[model samples]
Target: MSPEEAPARRRGRPTGSRAGAPETREAILAAARSEFAARGYAKASIRGIARTAGVDPALVHHHFGTKEKLFGAALEFTFAPALVVPEILEGGPEGVGERLARRFLSTWEVPEVRERLIAVMRSALTEDAAAAMLREFVSRELLLRIAAQLDVPEPHLRAELAASHMVGMAVLRYVLQVEPLASADPEELVGLVAPALQRYLTER
Candidate 1:
């Protein structure tokens, strides 16, 4: 065969990483995180991640099985609402704001998750790189997912605004302990905050 006629080299691993190899698994996870961080959960794909990791796509499926599971592994953030947010959505959109607010508040109240969140938040606050990754993960994975569910104009803006309110509330009430808000009952706070959130969520 002529040199110019040689078949193009196939990219990535030929047969995928051997099953149950820790180093290969870690490489796939690292690639998954990078893809997720750059492209967001909704847009990132198994094929793309595999390409980035220099592995066959089958390897990714072998390691993580599903996109949701892969995202969970890549993130390793127990405090993220991505898991339970859909359950909260199942009650319908009429009371999404109230449900979302209550859910967000309740999530922060978990003892183990709270401790881990504090550590992540502290790292983000202190490190520029960590903060950027955290910001992207929140915007793409969490906020965008919630926003896309709403049948509203400017879904991205709406999601961001609603999330801003919730994050601000969390920081003030839970982190900074700003009085009144800090001391207020969860139900009372939900009542006070839900209307604005509802407006952002449902209104045009």
Candidate 2:
């Protein structure tokens, strides 16, 4: 076929281009963050993210392997609420505790994310780079966003309490794999845990 008649080459993923070119990868990651922030993990689409990045969807797929992997990458970089809780605060203050608890627990169950979370937690405890990342995210993205959503007076304090409680549950259930806690039905755990979080966030 003539050059004019040949198929148009995709941008970012050039013909014979190497995988993970710095500019392309950074572009994709930035677009991924924007997409995740706007749509949350479950609703964010690879096609949409690729478009946002000015790349092909196949490039994104080849780069990350799966949505779970991409989400994990996003979290490892910044630990934003979009990937962490998806849209936990979207439904408003009603049942937010259940939303937060359910989302947090379920997100930790994803294998790709679980691995990164382990790394993050360990590094955080040891005061590494991940520690700074987590601290910034929790203080800015997680806590303040959550605090802003609630009707409570000490919203920041309430948000902090809820985050601590949730993280403690994760340590026992996921990191340590404590029996009963680890083995318990998720709904049952959510039932047990959501009320306290709700009280922390909403109770005046």
Candidate 3:
């Protein structure tokens, strides 16, 4: 090899030297969440997220492939509720209402879950992509799980009704913080709300 020939420039892009792929991916996700929050999913761009993350646009594409998938990853927190929902539904159908209410309210009362949900809800209000992702996840995962367990006419409708009431209660208790509803004991709230949820799940 002649000295002027030069050692071939190593191919492709240089690897990130400090963080491994997983850490860089996480950084991208964190930046994506912030970008989506600030700009909403429709306006949030791969280049913008990459800029916020201090990584190249190609890295974002390399990790997530597209804006849609990046938005989905940004909203990954929404999936955690699915994990707890089945546990809440696990008992005999008899007092499922009370169990569901107790568990649902209890779970969201945690600071982390409450804050995360508030952020998702805020994003969902303004972003069609955010709304679609959340709506699809809940309908398919949470509501349908309960509906499938019921042996009732129009079980899907029944499950939806039950979910609606719980959702309203959650909004009031956690989001709106409405008066006594927000401060009411979980047991007391269960007493007031569970019977209606029970009727929805079992009746007709």
Report residue 38 deviation for candidate 3 (angstroms): 4.9
Which candidate ranks first by TM-score, i.e. highest? Answer: 3
Tens-place lDDT per residue, model 1, 32-134, is: 7666555655667899998888777888898889876776565564444555765676677899889988888788777655554555555557656556666
Best to worst by TM-score, what's the order? 3, 2, 1
- Least accurate 10 contiguous residues by lDDT in model 1: 4-13
Candidate order (lDDT)? 3, 2, 1
Residue range 1-204, candidate 2, lDDT tens digits:
568434444343442253457887778877877776556555678999988988778888888888667755766574543344425666777898898888887877787566556655765575444355567767777677666677889888988898889889889988899998988988898999999988997789
Q: How does candidate 1 score on lDDT?
A: 0.72
Cα TM-score per model? 0.61, 0.62, 0.76
Clash count for each candidate, listed in order shown:
0, 0, 0
Please give the distance, in angstroms, between residue 145's alpha carbon in candidate 2 and its true position after superposition: 1.6
Who wins the lDDT comparison? 3
Clashing pairs in 3: none
Instruction: Judge candidate 2 against the unseen true structure and give its global Cα lDDT, from 0 to 1.
Output: 0.73
TM-score of 3: 0.76
